[model samples]
Target: MKKLRVGSVLLAGIVAAGAAWAHGGATGIVKERMDAMSDIGGQMKAVGRMLRAGSYDPALVSSAGATIAGHAGKTLVDLFPEGSLEAPTEASPAIWTDRAKFRAYSDELQEAARAMKQLADRGADMQEVAGAFASLGGTCKTCHEAFRIKK
Candidate 1:
C-alpha cells in the first residue's frame, strides 16, 4: 500500500514537471506567431498591389492595417523567449545571445504597427497614407535585416 502511494506521487510530480517544461519550450509558439505574421504580410502586399493599381478601397486598406497592428502587438513578443531557438525555429541563437537588440527590433515592429494603425484610423489624405505605408514597410525591412532569416 505504501509503495503504491509513493509511486502515484512520483507520477504526479513527473507530470507536473513535464507541463512546466513544455510551457518553456516555445518552438511551436514561434512557428505560430511567424505564420500569423506571414499571413499579415501577404494581406499587406495585396492591399499595396491594389493601391498601386489604383483600385484599392481606403476602407479595405485601413482594415488590413488594423489587423496587422492587432496581431503584431499581441503575438510577436510572446513568441520569443530564452529557449525559442529550436529546429524549424529560424530564430537564431543571436536572439538569445543579443537579447537587448532582439528586443529593440520587436519593440520597433510594435511601435511601427501602432503608428500605422493610428494613421489608418485617422483616415488621412492619400498622400499621407501612402507615406505612412512606406514607413511601415521600412520598419519591416529593418527588423528582417537584423533578426529574421530569409527563406
Candidate 2:
C-alpha cells in the first residue's frame, strides 16, 4: 500500500508538469508587453506634464500624441486578451472575468486615442484641443483604475 501511494503521488506530479508545459506559459511575452506598456505610460505622463506646464511645442505634442495613440490603441489591448494575462501580467484578473467592462474601458481608450490623433493631425489650436486632451487623459485614468494594478 505504501509503495502504491508513492507511485500515485509521482504520477500526479508528472501529469501536473505535463499540463503546465502544454500550456506554453507566459514568461517572455508578458515581460515584453509590460515593458512596452510602461514605456508608453512614461511617455504619456511626460506629454501631459509638458502640456500642462505651458512649455510644450505644438509640433512635439502632435508627434508624441501620434506615438501614444499608435501604441495605446494597438498594443495595449493585444496584451490583455482573456488568456494573455496568465502570469507576469500586471493586468488584473478582472480584465478577463469581467470582460465586458474591461472591453468597454479598452474601447474608450482606443476612441480617445483616435480622437486625440485626429485633433492633433488637424493642427487645431491648442486651446481648442484642450478638451480632447482632457478626454484622452480621463480615458486612460478610467481604464487604469478598473483594470491595471498599481505598481
Candidate 3:
C-alpha cells in the first residue's frame, strides 16, 4: 500500500509536469496529439487519485485502461508525420530519426494498458492494479524522456 501510494504520487508529479507545457498555440496535428495525450494524462490522474484514496474501482480502471489503449500504439504514431514540429510542440526530432524505437514505446504503452484492463476486468486486487499502473507510468516516462523536448 505504501509503495502504491508513492508510485501514484510519482506518476501524478510526472503528469503534472507535462501539463505545465503550454498547448494553447498548438494547432493541426500537433494540437490533436496534444489533446490525445491530455486525455491519457487525465485518465492516469483519475486512476491515481482513486488509488491514493483507497477506492479501487475495477470498473473505472478497466474503462480508463481501455481509453488509453484506444489512443496509443498506431493511433499515437500516426499523429507524428515528417517535420510536423510547429511552435509550442514538444516532440523531438528523434521520434522520426528513431522511428522504430518510438513505435516500440507506443506499443509498450498499449500493451501495458491492455494488461491493466485485463487485470481490472478479472477483478484483480488493488496491489496488482497499482503495479500495472506503475508499469504504465514507467513506459510514459521512458518515452517522454526519449522523445519530448522540455521547455
Candidate 4:
C-alpha cells in the first residue's frame, strides 16, 4: 500500500536518526544523563506493567520506587552541568532558562516516588500503589512536557 510504504520510510528515518546519534557515541554529561534517564524509564515501565496487570509484586514495586526516588531532584540536576546539551540529549534550553520550575518538577517526582515506595514497603494493596504510581507518573509527564524535546 502507498500509505504503508510512506509510514515505513518515516519510521526508518526516525530509527536511523537516533542510531546516528547513538548515546554511546556521546561522551561526558550527555551520556551519563541519557543512561540514567533510560534506567528511570525502564524502571517506570516495569512497575507500570506490574500495576496494570493487577498481579503486582510489592517488593519489586518497592525496589523500582527506590531506584526512581534515588535519582530524583538533585541527582537529576547534577547530571546536567552547564551546556551539557551537546548531542543525544532530550533536554531543551527551556530547562536552563526555567531552572526553578524544572527543579520543582524533579522534587515532585521524588516526593511521589518516595510515597509509592513507602506504601509498597508497608505491604499496601494494589489500589494504593497504583494511586502513588499515578502521582509519580504525573510528575514525569509534567516535567517531560515542559523540558524534553520530542526527538
Candidate 5:
C-alpha cells in the first residue's frame, strides 16, 4: 500500500510537470486551461510537500482541495471548446472526439477533490487524509493518460 501510494504521487507529479511545461507559448482558451492546470499542479505540490514533511495541516489540505474542485468539472470542460487545439496545448484531440468520456473524467476529478476536502475538514487521520490525496492523484493520472498529449 505504501509503495502504491508513492507511485501514485509520483505519477501525479509527472503529469503536473508536463502540464506546466505545455503552458509555454499557449494563448487564449488554451492558455486559460493550461494556467488552471498549472495552478492545480502548484496546489498538489504544496500538499505533497506537507505530507512528506509530516506536517499534516487539515485546513491547508482542505483549502487546496477546494481550490482544485473549483477549477474542475464544468469549468475545466468549458475551457476546451471543440477544435481549440492551439499551439502548445497538451490537450489531445481525443477530448473532442470522446466528449462524454472527457466530461466524465473532469467530473470524477471534481468529485475526488471534494471528497478529499471533506475528509480533511473532518479532521481525518493522517493515513485517511493521505489515502484521499492518493485517490485524487490517481484520478489525475488516469485522466491525463487518457486525454493529455505528451510533449
Candidate 6:
C-alpha cells in the first residue's frame, strides 16, 4: 500500500508539471503580440492615472491615445495569424474561429481610441475626456473578455 501511494504521488507530480508547461513561454508571433499588449496596458494605466488625478493633460492624453490606436484595428488582428497560438499564449482559439467577431472588436477598439484622441485634440474639458477614456476602457474589457483566455 505504501508503494502504491508513492507511485500515485509521483504520477500526480508529473501530470502537474506537464499541465504547467502547457501554458509556458511563447515565441514568434505569440511573443510579439504579448509585448504589444503589455505596452497598451501600460499606456492605458498611465492615462487612467492622469484621468483619476484630475490633472487633465491633453497633450499626454493625445500621445497615449495615439499609441493605443496604433495597436488597434487591423494592426492588432494581424498580430494573431492563423495557428499563432504557440505556448504561453492566453489568446483564445475563438479569435481565429470567430474571426469576424474578433475583427469587429478590433474595429471598436480603434474607433474608441480615435474618438478619444480627437477629444484630446479638441481640448475637451475633463468630463468629456473622462467619458472618452471610459469608452476606451469598455472596449478593451469587451475584447479581453471575449478573446483573452483566463489563465
Instruction: Give the alpha-carbon lDDT of every model.
Output: 0.59, 0.59, 0.89, 0.75, 0.84, 0.76
- Cα shift from native, residue 24, model 6 (Å): 8.0
Better of 4 and 5 by TM-score: 5
Candidate 6's clash total is: 0
**What is the Cα-based lDDT of residue 131 in candidate 4?**
70
* Clash counts for all predictions: 0, 0, 0, 0, 0, 0
* Prediction 5 global C-alpha lDDT: 0.84
Better of 1 and 3 by lDDT: 3
> By the lDDT metric, which is better: model 1 or model 4?
4
Models, CA RMSD each: 20.0, 19.6, 1.9, 8.9, 3.0, 15.1
Candidate 6, residue 109: the lDDT equals 87
Candidate 5, clashing residue pairs? none
Query: What ranges in model 4 sit over 4 Å off?
Result: 1-24
Candidate 2 Cα errors over 4 Å, as ranges? 1-27, 81-88
Best by TM-score: 3
- In TM-score terms, candidate 3 sits at 0.92
Predicted candidate 3 versus true structure: per-residue lDDT over 62-93, tens digit per residue: 99999999999999999999898998898999
Pairs of colliding residues, candidate 6:
none
Q: After superposition, how far is residue 99 of candidate 1 from its true place, in Å?
A: 2.3
Write out the backbone clash pairs for model 1.
none
Best by lDDT: 3
lDDT of 4: 0.75
Question: What TM-score, computed on C-alpha atoms, does each candidate reach?
Answer: 0.70, 0.67, 0.92, 0.82, 0.89, 0.82
Query: Model 4: which ten-residue window has the lowest total lDDT?
Result: 1-10
